[model samples]
Target: MAIDILVVDDEEMIRWTLKEALESEGYNVRAFENGRDFLAYFNEHGSDIILLDVRLPDSNGLDLLLEVTRVDPDAIVVIMTAYGDVETAVNAMKRGAFDYLAKPYSLEEVSLLINKIVQANLLKSQLHHYQEMLENKFSRILGENQKMKQLREHIGMAARTDRTTVLIRGESGTGKELVARQIHFQSARADKPFIDVNAAAVSSTLLESELFGHEKGAFTDAQKQKKGLFELANGGTLFLDEIGDLDPSLQVKLLRVLQERKFRRVGGTSDIHVDVRIISATNADLEKAIEDGRLRQDLFYRLNVFTVNLPPLRERRDDILLLAKNFLEEFRKEFSKDISGFRDDTLRILEGYSYPGNVRELRNIIERATLLETGNLIRPASLPDELKKSSDLGYVAFSQETAKPWQSTGFNFKDYIDSVEKQIVTEVMHEVEGKKSRAAEVLGLTRFALRHQLKKHNLESD
Candidate 1:
């Protein structure tokens, strides 16, 4: 859409010149002879930018600027005045003008100034949209349980700070990285870069170079000077994942940096300083590692300033369906599928089994089911065999009937448990005439829990 610009000048020549020039540049330009006329028109219509003469016959342009700004906080107004009124122009700017234009300026200068305003507004709009997208994508720390609520409070507190180092401890697949990112994106350093490195993923020999950079010819593969994650995340955040796995040699260097806010590059003598908020995550027990001489004691104390521990999905059963639905909606859009929800059998299976892999596993299961779904909802047929198996949570008991792992090629105990549980739930629901309240009373379960079970078993409709 063409940006609407209102030009208010008492001189007929000045008003006509701006209106014609801006209109030629594809703006919806309107001209007024005085502040009164401009205010009258603006009351009924909306404009993106305003070009007003500082001296109006009926009103002071500064007063008019204040009025427009009061009406619309985001209003953009530029003041126009004769030469030697730079001070007045500056004062007008203090009164909320977007800019000041000196009189006797060429038409080309006018066009350039207007173009800059339009581009700035465009950039602002794009930035707002981008931030919204990031929030939607990364802000899904879903849970209705008390533990989750407490976790959210801690996250809020951590995100409000500027430079507190954070330590996130959780089992693999528990979304430690997600927690780290939420903290970074919500803090004062949100607009800065968020760099992450995994101690376990990279080789111990190369981890230092990767994290601390190196000078030209620092090593055989160091063809040129390179910047480390610290430099890349300067004035931002650096996430050190699997911090417990950091090699002992690197641990000393890391401690030095944490203490002094400086480091010497791998094979480089010059000390590099950085202002980085370190957020470290580890699935390992740093305390035990410290005792075992694996992790440095001082480093653990430094990084453990604020610790956040995420619960396993099985422990937070209330969030299973919640997370499943979230993943469902995400995959629905990603795969462009019409899949609505899970079927009765599928829900029971999902709820009954203990997710040893936690939330990440559930998401992967849902993703796979979504892609394989041919109907409007996911069913037991769409679920993996392991999910449908009725194991004693751990499924640790192998088939005694089939001898051991060597003798049996195919045997499953989880299948038997699943069928038995499904049958019992199905028959109970039938006996209650599909009444959840009556079923819960007979089965010795709470209505809240019964509802989740019913949904898991695709017995909600019943």
Candidate 2:
């Protein structure tokens, strides 16, 4: 792999010698005499590696190292210092330099160090890229929740095969898109495009053309041939959000494509075969739709080859605080605020309310609170009136499950224990919106133990 290396030193002879040696070793080397020149070049075209001198005419190398690292934390910085200037080089290293080299170093020694640094940088770059992708693309999905953990496992299993047609069912804000994205990113066609189409957003007249393309002069607006989402997502995945909202006629067309893997443009004769995966999501119950003859049974079965149900926030009360924290961190960065955390009473309110809108609602609440919070902690007054009212005093009473065993009933010890456990789990679950992990934390129980108790009580989640 070709490497871009910037060598900075006040001495021309050292720069020329090092540049020549590195160039001979097949690296693209650029040299600068001062920190100003290096900074200018870095601003124009960033280098993958920066070699800095500890003592320069313009500025100290430690200061320059800090600037470079701030500009690109992933940049590989190799510092140069005199034998006694090791202390300054060590300081640079502490400030995020990859390594340091003593002054009057041999050309061969510099070449060897560059080679090792470049190779290490390449690996780090690859790892960092994957890490960024995973975090940015999948971090919203906190797999600590039991349902999310199971969904993740299912996604892994489905990614290994092409026959899996996943149907993601959930409430409006339950992160159906996130689940679909996870499937596409983990599948064999991860490198390929993942096309998203909102079936509910398009009109019945245009939805067909949007999914299966349209030839020139196919309709009044069709000025030229246009590729559809299916063609765009050829080898990858096509996420059909609100698939249940597709028009009845379009449902027939979609069903045909699912069965035959072939579709034709609106005005074209030849069939276009696509090796695409379909991951559809909807808040509607397709079985009921089929029973009402609004959706076809064959198509429902085809899409439901594999199904993943996402529980609403109210159902996963244990995850309420965790999700709140995640949202708080995100909003804090978004709004450039330094709000530390939620107040105990604030958290109490958040945990008590049933998030009818699920994770999406929680995100909006955190965003609003982060922006409104003038102090270090978020207070209940920062929340909407509806939330505050619902979660005020009544919520505290409903949510508190930390009473001693002695507080429970005395009649029938086993039955009393079951009742207490059920009540505690139920209350905590309500607080966390059915998030088993957070509920378990609130109730002082393990996730596995909570699941066991939940099964034991046969109690309904919030």
Candidate 3:
């Protein structure tokens, strides 16, 4: 897009000079001899950069600056005046002028200032784009289940309370950290820093100093003063993962900080005050940990002001395929594959398995399958052996001795037998690479009998 520059000055010579110089620099320059003409043109066609002289025939530049800012708060207006004084410059800036230019200013200075503004605008645009991507990536909690809906509602409530501490409880790999991040990014402190640490990943000796800054020479390795996660996350959020694994001794210090909003760094005497929202997550059973003395009860109460409990994947079975397809699309783009969708049998296998590792495990499974798949659609052959073995059709077993034929109102024995036989025959054929003799051998049947079974089950082509 071409940059538009507007020059408003009562002096014809100055207006012509600016218009010529700015047009030479490839800007769409428009010159006006008075504030009345400038305002009329501005109301019709807005410009990117505005140069307004204070000594206008009809109006004051400071008053015009207020009007421009009132109409468009982001308007970049540069004040131009031959009688430039400290008070006039300050007044222009107070009225929302971008900068002040005294009379007899060089074109070089104007070019430099314009370049700086352009660069700043470019950076602002890039930052806005990235922020949008981040919000879209983390804000979505992909599930239509009632539990998930309630969880989102709880997250919104927690985010509204800026100072409240939040504790997320869930099984490992059930998106505890994801919930913590969602709360932080959706809150009022979204623009500030968000730092995260795993309590279990750091050693007890270093974890204290990691949470709170230390003075120079405070310890053997402390050569310089260092700020900790708490200080860095001031006015923002600090996500502490696996909070149950924090050392008991440090828990006392943490409790004091929560209660008093101040803490002394390791080997430091003076207390440092900070305003940080703490969002902690733990997969461990906190009630059990409190009873076993592994976690402090007082600290638990402080961190548990707002709690979000995530449901395991098996309980919300309806969302399994939803999450799976989402992961598949994500991986397909990442791996640069041409895969379109999952096969019907593959979808069944994905939806039937109990995900012990939850969403993270399903993501990994999709990633691996997307990378390894050779066909247009994701088939059962692309899945892991464990998934295929544990699929709904994989474990079917029927015996006449123990069968209750008339148990159901509309039971059809022949149909049930035929379905089971067809599934077994299909699985055997897949295992044997569609070799009828090998499939028959595996099923304990002769070639003729296997052929008859294949024709009956609509597997004649195979």
Candidate 4:
């Protein structure tokens, strides 16, 4: 994208000089003779950079700068002033002008100022692009289940306000951090920082210093001053994962910060005020913790202002296939594979299994299947052994240890035979510790035939 430069000066020679000079630098330059003509063009098509003469024939350049800033707060305007009116140029900068150019200024000076502005704008553009990508990534909460629909509504309500503390309750792999990100990206503080830390991942002493930084020489290891997550996330959000594991000593300090919106460093005397939204998540039951005296009731009250309870995967079985398909598409593009979809038998296996690890485990399953699948569609052969063992496709009653196949209603003979063959190959490979040549000799089969069997059962990687 070429930078568009708008030159607004009453003098025809000045306008012509700027247009020719900037155009030679590969910029899209447009010139106007007066403020009225410039305003007309600007109202229709905005420019990336503006050069406004301080003394326009129709209007004051300062007033025009205010109007431009009011319309577009990000507008980069450089004030063109006379050498005698240096104070006016300074005032222009205070009023949001990017910089100033004095009359009798050389074209070289103008080029240098424009280059600086271009570099600054380039950085801002990149940051904005990255922020947009983050928002897009976290905004997707995929599900069609009723609970999921209501959960989305709850997330929206939580995002509508900036002061409310959010508590996300879910199992370990159920995306508690993901919900925290969604709240942060959807809120008014979307452009600000979103910092997170796991309360249980660090020791109590270190976690204290991590959340509320220490003063210089505050302790034996505190050699220099450092900013904490709360201070770093000022005007943004700080997500505390596994909040239930926060130490009791730190809980008192955190409660003070939440109640008063202020805190002091570990050994510092001065109080530091901050405006940060705290979003805490945990897999433990806070009510139980409070009863057991592990969690402070007051702190729990403060953190639980807005609660979002995520449903476990087993509770919302209808969304299993929906999430599976979404992950399949994601991995397809990522792996550059031509997998069109999941086979019917594969879908049965996927939908039948109980995901103890929830959505995270399901994603891993699909990712592994997508990589191992050799055909146009994901087949049951690509699934893990656990899923096959528990699948409702007539394999659940077959006992590998006893070599017994129990007969049941709606049992498919072909699937039963395939399961038996897969189990035998799996057991033989496991017995030999995945040494294919030795396993082939034990099974009285050729090496090529063993390799073929392993591929058929999707155990080639093992």
lDDT of each: 0.80, 0.78, 0.81, 0.83
* Candidate 1: tens digits of C-alpha lDDT, residues 1-462: 347899999999999998877765446788999888899889788689999888899998889999999888899999998754768888888989999899888899898898677656654664475477576852478899898998888889999988889999888899998898788878888766777899999998888887888776778976546667786677778999999999999999888888999998767777888899999999887888999999888899999999898987767876777888889999999999998898754654576556667898999999999999999989777888766653232222242321232232333565555555654666577556678789989889999988887777565772
Question: Which is the better candidate, 3 or 4, if ranked by lDDT?
Answer: 4
RMSD to the hidden true structure, all candidates: 16.8, 16.6, 15.9, 14.1
Error of 3 at 453 (Å): 34
Candidate 2 TM-score versus the reference: 0.59
The lowest-lDDT stretch of 10 consecutive residues in candidate 1 is: 399-408
How do all models score by TM-score?
Answer: 0.59, 0.59, 0.59, 0.60
Let me know the TM-score candidate 4 reaches against the reference structure: 0.60
Please write out the lDDT profile of model 3 over residues 1-462, one tens digit for every residue. 347889999999999998877765446789998878888889888889999999898999889899888878898999998997889999999998889899889999887787666546644654475477575542268899999999999999998999999999988889987787778778888766677899999998899888986766788977545667786677778899999999999899889889999998776789889899999999888999999999989999999998999998867877887898888888888889999999866776676566668888888899999999999999888999866554433231232322243352345566546655776786678657689999999999999999999998777882
lDDT tens string, model 2, 315-430? Answer: 67778888898888878887889899987767766876777688999889988999999999998779997675444233333445533333423324554345445556666775
Q: Where is the poorest 10-residue window by lDDT in model 4?
A: 395-404
Ranking of predictions according to lDDT: 4, 3, 1, 2
Looking at candidate 1, what is the lDDT of residue 42? 90
What digit string (tens of lDDT, one per residue) describes model 4 on residues 1-462?
358999999899999998877765557899987888888889888889999998988999999999888888989999998754768978999999999888889999998898778656654654575567565542268899999999999999999998999999998788888788788878998767777899999999998888888776788976556557787677789999999999999999999999999999878899999999999999987999999999999999999999999988867877888899889988999899999998766776676566768899999999999999999999888999877774543333443421233334345677766666776776577557689899999989999999998887677982
Clashing pairs in 4: none
Q: How accurate locally is residue 118 in candidate 1, as Cα lDDT from 0 to 100?
A: 61
Instruction: Please give the lDDT score for candidate 4.
Output: 0.83
Give RMSD (Å) of candidate 2 vs. truth: 16.6
